[model samples]
Target chain A: MSAVATYVRLAWAWTRALAQYPASLAMLTAAQAVATVGELAALVFLFGHAGRLGGFGLHEALLVYGLAGLAFTLADLLMGSVERLGEHIRTGAFDVMLVRPVPALLQVAVEEFSPRRLGKVVPCAAALGWALAALPAEWTPLRAAAVPVLVASGTVICCSVWVIGACLQFVALDAREAANAVTYGGQAMAQYPLAVYGRDVARAATYVVPLAFVSWQPALYLLERPDPLGMPEWLRFAPPAVAALLALVAAAVWRAGLRRYRSTGS
Target chain B: MEAVIEAEGLGKDYTVAEGPLPRRRRRRVSAVRDVSFRVAPGEVVGYLGPNGAGKSTTLKMLIGILAPSAGRVRVAGLEPVRARTRLARRIGVVFGQRTTLWWDLPLRDSLALTRHLYRVPRADHARRLAELTEVLELGPFLATPVRQLSLGQRMRGDLAAALLHAPEVLVLDEPTIGLDVVSKTAIREFLLRLNAERGTTILLTTHDLGDVQRLCRRVMVIDGGRLAFDGGLAGLHAVAPSPRTLVVDLAAPAAPIAVAGARTVRVEGPRQWLELNGNPARVIAQVAADHEVADITLREPDIEEVVHRIYAGR
Candidate 1:
């Protein structure tokens, strides 16, 4: 049949498989809810007493937090273990991906689905509402449309980092824990204001990996604030723009890595 | 003869590098080199090699999973890796070490999925599943989660899963590597039938030599990333027309008639194996006449011995 048709069929199979383990799925979902809500509660506790840290109020921090949580959860839930590309690539399972008759990224992207991530996705939406209610906002149609678009862009950027991390596994099979700095660490740090860090580091993150686009800058535009970092308004939409660039760059790296994927024995 | 699969001058090179804390490229390692082979339609050819041999690499190239550094490959008149969706519909692949079937899903669901993924007709799916379930003996575990099934049961299910698409070509890498004897035999028999009746061309890379002897008529042996030998299984082991093995069920341990024409290959708890090296008719007649034969059985010189002898250069 068609490629889209095949994806749908396999995705159905994936969902059905997730349905088989109801208790595990429930536990995972609950754990995600607990994690997301727990993190938000910690933010409230810390910032409630402190008043403001990094120029972000408790409610404003939730904006960055909720968006990042939603983006990461959506990508993680669909891609499953692909978020752990460094590990999979270090092992030889990545080779199985290369030999299949589809685009390697497409195959990797569709590899696993985690329903437990719905725990975080739903909570993120709830937190977004809470944050919006707590903080006054000028909600134009453009700003409203930018929310999910930004989330999608952030997901793409995060996935790009994952793909790049996977490509690096060819050189350092174990990923030297540095790959995590790009993937999981980047995800964790992306939810906060990049301005919290030094100019050099934030610039590196913004220009090199471009993770800052996912939240910090876009939050600037949505919050209608002065350019604290002195970047253009368009720069806040860097999540999608950088995601697009990173995606192309990631495809190139994947191709280069495929040329370099020396398959190992079982 | 039309080639369903072809590869020429296939080679893969990997860089081995060590650098700073984050990004560095400095090392070089060549995994496969100068490998070439062709598989014709309806032919069951075994790709045999020891550990570290480039069998998986070759299979990857054929399947379009890996892009060769320098070479060309075509499967069933198409570039599989480049046209994966088309190839997915035309071929079935199974990795013995890992199951593609979902762990939580039942065998039926997995099979139903294969049917849908391959876009098999509804009636065709039912008919094929029923036949495979019977042939692979998957009836008992059809509704059970694939994870819950024993290794043998899971293997049988995987075999059926790979065949659901009725792929014109089946690339089985280590298909029976760790199966029980019964499971192995059942898979072998099924593969033999598949090739005979449906003319499904099979290129199997297996560590299990018995699979080669029983299921594959021709064999390709690769060593150190290169094609070492590509020919018939029998020619790999030179023998003087010793058609059958004399498995003498001796009445007693010392129930020896003579060991002149054949070699006593093994002596187990209660039985003895004689590799009938000479004329089968003469050996059988002489043994029957001389010994009080309680019972006797015949066996074939397996591809295991042949491949072992070849590897050892005996």
Candidate 2:
């Protein structure tokens, strides 16, 4: 029928792929929840001792952590397939994706809908929500003012990392962990106050890639605080523009890699 | 009949690396050398070659999977590499080694997914599935997980999956390589009906000669990454000169009875192998009825021998 209809069908199939394995999906979701809670124990201890680090209190830190965690895990669920894309190309598995009537990029993006990673995501989401409710603040206006921008920017950053990782595999099959290091490390460091990692790491993260925007910067505005660093207060919403730029650059890299794909020996 | 696929001087070159941490070196190998041909609509063509014969490379070129190193290919009026978006909708491919299926999902889920991806109408999907499952005997395994299927079962499912889209052109690579006799027969019969009844153009690359004999009227042979033979099956045989062989395993090894039109070759305990005069099927039938024969068989020379004969003549 229509091209959009075909994409919808393929996306449905990908979701069903996860549904087919209920136990795996359930287990992963629980694992993610537990991990997020476990990470919160650390957040609680660090924030309990010191009232604020780089001007972020307990609730604000949890806000950034939870949203970033959710976005990262959501992207991981699909992007895992993109990482294995090299092996797919090497084994000629990519050929199957190519023969379909849909766009190759769309087909590959939804190819893997992983269910297990939620073992960490659900807990992070809960912690973020819990932190939001427990804090003595106006909840309705805060979320309205910030959550959509938070989700969009976080998604763009995660999607950009996913594409970059996949593209790197196209060039060098063995460099997967290196890509993971940047993605996982970036998310972890950005979830907390940059003032903890000292000035250089925080500044590099702030202006260069702007990983801090997802959690650190925007949470400042929601929490109604000034920048812990000597920088201006408006840098809090900086992640979205950075996210958009990274997404565009990531897609460009992917197109270049597609041209360079030699495929398998056939 | 109009040509559904056309190719001119298509080629693929590959460079392989040698040595891990030792003296580094490299080698350049060509998987496909300038090959060209055309297939008429509603025609079934067989592509045959020994291992590493570039048959697969050429098929990939037609399907837009591999970009050709040189030359051009047009399948259904679209350039394979330059116009893949437009080309993908109208082609169905089955690479027997791969299922193109979701491993964890049920057979039906994967089928439904394909139906959606192809944008098949709900009514059309229901009818196609009913017709395909009937011919391929896929009902029993509809809800079963794909990871649990046997090779033959999977192969049949793959064939059925490929045909679901109702594409104008079908490309099958070694479609019946590991199937049991019953399944092989079913697949062959279904393919024949599809080509004749549905009028779909088919390009088949298979190791099984029986698959070629049963399904295709025209056969193309490639050797050493190059085109070796192209034309009808009759022309193919004429190119092979291993003196048509007739082998008979007798009930009693009745003394190598001198047949008028055939030359007797080797005689074993209960077997007699003979070189016949041109037509061996007629002689074998007559000899089988005349002699006290327990079992009889007629064999075309193996592909290797045929290739050898063609080379010798050259």
Global lDDT for candidate 2? Answer: 0.78
Off by over 4 Å in 1: A1-12, A86-104, A110-112, B12-33, B121-123, B207-210, B239-257, B264-274, B279-304, B311-314
Model 1 docking grade: acceptable
Expressed as tens digits, the lDDT of each residue in B1-314 for candidate 1 is 98999888988776666788579767766668988888889999999877777888788778776678788888988876567567866888888887867677898888887676566899998998888888778998899999899888888888888888788999998988778888888889989999999999999998776787788788887777877778887765553132457888766665434666777777774477777768777877787687666788877655444445566763
In DockQ terms, which candidate is top?
Answer: 2
Task: Report the C-alpha lDDT of model 1 over A1-266, residue by residue, as the tens digit.
Answer: 46666666666677778877789879988998998888878877887998887787888888888777777777666654554555556555665555344455655666665667788889888877787666567778988888778888878877777778767766666773777677778778877766667677677777887877777776777788765666667787566768888889988987787655556655
Instruction: Score candidate 1 by TM-score against the native.
Output: 0.84
lDDT of 2 by residue, A1-266 (tens): 46556645565666677776678777767777777787888888988898787666787777767777777776666555676677777777788888876667666776665556656667777877876676555767755667777767877787787788778977787777887787887878867767677777868877666677666666666666666666777676667787888888988998788766666654
Residue pair clashes in candidate 2? A1-B119, A28-A119, A29-A118, A29-A119, A31-A119, A32-A119, A32-A120, A33-A119, A33-A123, A217-A236
Q: Per-residue alpha-carbon lDDT of model 2 for B18-68, expressed as tens digits? A: 898487778888998999998989989998888788999899889887788
